[model samples]
Target: MLKQNLSPDLTPLRHAHRLATLYSYEILDTQRESVFDDITRMASTICRTPIASITLIDAERQWFKSEIGLGKSQTPISASICAHVVLENDVLVIADTSADRRFGGNPLYTGDPDLKFYAGAPITTADGVTLGTMCVLDTVSRSLTQEQIDMLRMLARQVMMHLELRRMLRLSEKTSDYRARMLASAAHDLRQPLFVASLSVQSLLQEAAPHQLKRLTLANGGLETIKKGFNRMLIAASGHASFTLAELDDTDLGDVLEFIHANFLPLAERKDIRLSVLRTRLHVHSDAVQLETLIGNLVANAVKYTEAGGRVVVGCRRHADHVALHIIDTGIGMASESVNTLFEAFRQGDAQSEGLGLGLWIAKRTAEALGVSVQIHSVPGRGTHFILSLPLKASTEPSSEPIVQVR
Candidate 1:
């Protein structure tokens, strides 16, 4: 005997939560794939039904992720028999939709290519959320045999498994791409400084005693650059270190900015660019070392790109609930279009620019780890600004520490 229940019980809150879970899969409105199409086709053939569909119940619509002989991509949820199947979270076998009180008045049942029979197995996640159904429809009233019902249920599980697999595969591919880009950037950036240090030492050896002092100074400068490059590399590499949230401390933002100024000032001077920091008494919740690394990358990048007489400013602005740390640089600013790729590893605004272009990428990852927001604004030939918005640590009071000048 076919189970009969036209109007399935569902609560508004539960349905809304189900919709949220469905959206998280990101499967709605996507293109059809052979994996799902194969399942629907097989379901139709196995059940001896002319029509089969892999339906997804969205907010107000029944979308066909895959269909065989349905001849339609979607229909209103009100007109869908599968919507009831989602609520049941089990196989729904209606021997005759025309006789079933729940679906007899449904337009899909009375219209052309009339649907008289339906057998649906809920496509459910392991977490017990029913996304939709894998259903077979027929024009003539008929019941699915016990064996056929079991097969349909197995096929529904396959469909859900495929959806999960697809999502995992996509995530894996993205992670792999990210790792590749980071490796490429690290290799290129690390090589440049080491190469420069090697060449500086070689040139120093060839200089006469009278010019040895100048050559030695240049060699020392190259070593300093190498050390700075390694520092950036080490900070970026150590980002994956496991740390408990309990270890998070109240960080003085001003002190971190001062350290960035002191460290980058010499590099800025070498380029004949000015590096300045405007002191602020803002306190934020963050790890001091990680915060320093994040700010260091920004300051280094600013000084690296600015012209000889350009200025790079580091300051903080307090908002209602957060503090914005700004790294403003009068450098060769990037085009609006290029800004989108700035945080992508190995991507550079100017292909000829020094380093591997991973500074912003590292900075972005660090911000994410620290639970902060990073914003960027730039204009070509003018300048760029990177703002890191950090949540205020209300428990800590701001300090009246004197501003540290490194210029």
Candidate 2:
């Protein structure tokens, strides 16, 4: 028998955690972003549904981040199909809403849309707490193929990645000791998402077909990027004044490049930029998490500045006992004088560019901590190339104190 309550179990313990996790992202009631709208549009087309929405079920209402055809921005949770899915914590599908006894008396059916179909995949955080769903609805009775269902779920994961990225960036804005503590807390929270995402990719790979399998692989790559970034965030927060290496190990340059590709592919594609990575097996002896953080920041900044039709290529080569990681972008570059200030705190190169301009500064700090050198070459209105050089092996004389040196 179906549960009488349409909403989730309101047990104080679990419910509060779920709501707390949802609110922590600071996404509720925010203006719609094209990134999210793009996800919903893809769902509508892929699922062949007339109406699709990224539904966040808050305490009293379901706020739609990107409501494609619903016309309204939100509705009461009492009339929400997504709230029911929240309780199940999995993909929920109803071929014919009217035929389902669980939603028989729901007022949504009597509304203008007269919804008849729904397939919702949980938008679960790393903590395993479900905040909402990437759901598609149809006015006529219909069903989705297995592939469609998987794609829907995959899209939901992408939504979580964006939310996570935004959360980290928003919180990173505060540079106080208190902010570092908060960043540390946020970084620790990501542990749950990273582990869950890894396990999920493994399970999906075993059953996914060739095409779907490829996407799942890329999704795993995306997971690796987030995992490393947040782990580095923890490192940064823990030693706010001086970056610390959690572990010094053989870091694969190829894997880092692949991760960079997977994580930013969507953003680059959206900007009509060609993002490429050189296939390499070369390794560098450093903190794997720090490599991800610094390199991730460089690639992120490259993609942001590059114009449409421009290209960003990341590659590396061995030089003596060192490896020079190269990230070249055909973006609007800055003057050499402007480049000098790129690593300064709270610096902005382009007034029009969003962000506190702390990306490269963070990269510089991480590189210095790793005892590496960064070379930036750029021409205003031309392009930029950032080269990060580090020893192929760890230093023989390792100091416990933080290393501070000129770039």
Candidate 3:
């Protein structure tokens, strides 16, 4: 390592990109961490100094993340002697401040800088952006051996690793929160459909009609989708990983559509809407529960937006290499401008909209996780259409009995 001199460039090392990179760790002004305190204590022990600190430099100040024998938690950048370490590519050492004409009366945290000694290794990022330093100082004039200097550099590296690991955990927690919110919103949307199923069950118990019993069957299937999807989401959140559907073995698209139709049938009927599915016995490789969820959300949105007398249909057609499943709704379609931002979370055509505005966004995310492509076409005052292109991988068909509610 280069032993740097006191001749600092004097230019503030406040480069915007470098500051942004340091701030990415989200460690500034946070509560004191025991791990960092331990490192500083070890540094003091190894170098036999009265003071040691782990610091971070922002634009205006150098804040001590961890320190021992330092009375102050922070000081302005101009007052910080460690601030010069950011300008050095390697460790900087001043054997005796009293010998240096400019530092004869400088104020250090120990309140005795007349003849103090300082040694600091630049706390550098993997790409070599120096944030601050891991440093030790003494009121008496002294210097560290080459071995002690190398050890100080090693401690600097350990600081960087802890910062990196902490950043990753925080980012993972944010992603898990996002996915959990999506799942909770999705779970909220299913309640109305599920409640309608309960009503249908009551009618069947009173012997109102045989079709009433079919609605109950649809509710049962939808419950399975919720159970399986919830478990998958919990697993993803716990691991701080993205929601994945690697278990796409073989799924019956017909069965998937059948569940969608059953789940939303009663909701559509209450609004005097005709909800129907055009059946196809197509087999595709996908996660069945998540596939059903994607289709279910689209179908749910279709029923929600369509007028009382309008119609929403679900169907599929074969292409050369994939199957195009369609969700067509004759309702109050959105403008082209609104269609562009439909998949962004919480974005809606009307600010006073009815639902939470997560349906289309959830649909979009689910499609991505399942490796399905979604296309939307809509025009104001007419209708909206959704197309999902599923990968072509047909296998021996799964047993899918017809639902009575499908026309």
Question: In terms of lDDT, which candidate is strongest?
Answer: 2
lDDT tens per residue, model 1, 1-407: 33333554545414677888788777888766555776787789879999999999887788999998878899977787887788767789999887777865677777787789999999998779999999999999999987688778867876775565444333423553333234333543464455445544644655648757786777767776765564454344324433333366789887887888789888999999978888777789898887887888888888878999999988887676777777888889898778886776445666545554556766776677688898899888888888889878877555444423223
Backbone clash pairs for candidate 3 read none
Sorting all predicted structures by TM-score, with the top scorer first, yields: 2, 3, 1
In candidate 1, position 163 carries an lDDT of 67
TM-score of each: 0.43, 0.50, 0.44
lDDT over C-alpha atoms for residue 4 of model 1: 39
Quantify all predictions' global Cα lDDT against the true fold: 0.73, 0.75, 0.72
- For candidate 3, which ten residues in a row score worst on lDDT? 398-407
TM-score of candidate 1 relative to the true fold: 0.43
Residue 369 error for model 3, in Å?
Answer: 1.0
What's the CA RMSD of model 1 in angstroms? 20.3
> Can you write out model 2's per-residue Cα lDDT over 210-272, one digit (the tens) per residue?
889889999989888887786566546534463235666777767877888899999999999
lDDT of 3 at 161: 56
Stretches > 4 Å off in candidate 2: 1-14, 175-407
Badly placed stretches (over 4 Å) of model 1 are 1-246, 396-407
Local error of candidate 2 at 335, Å? Answer: 25
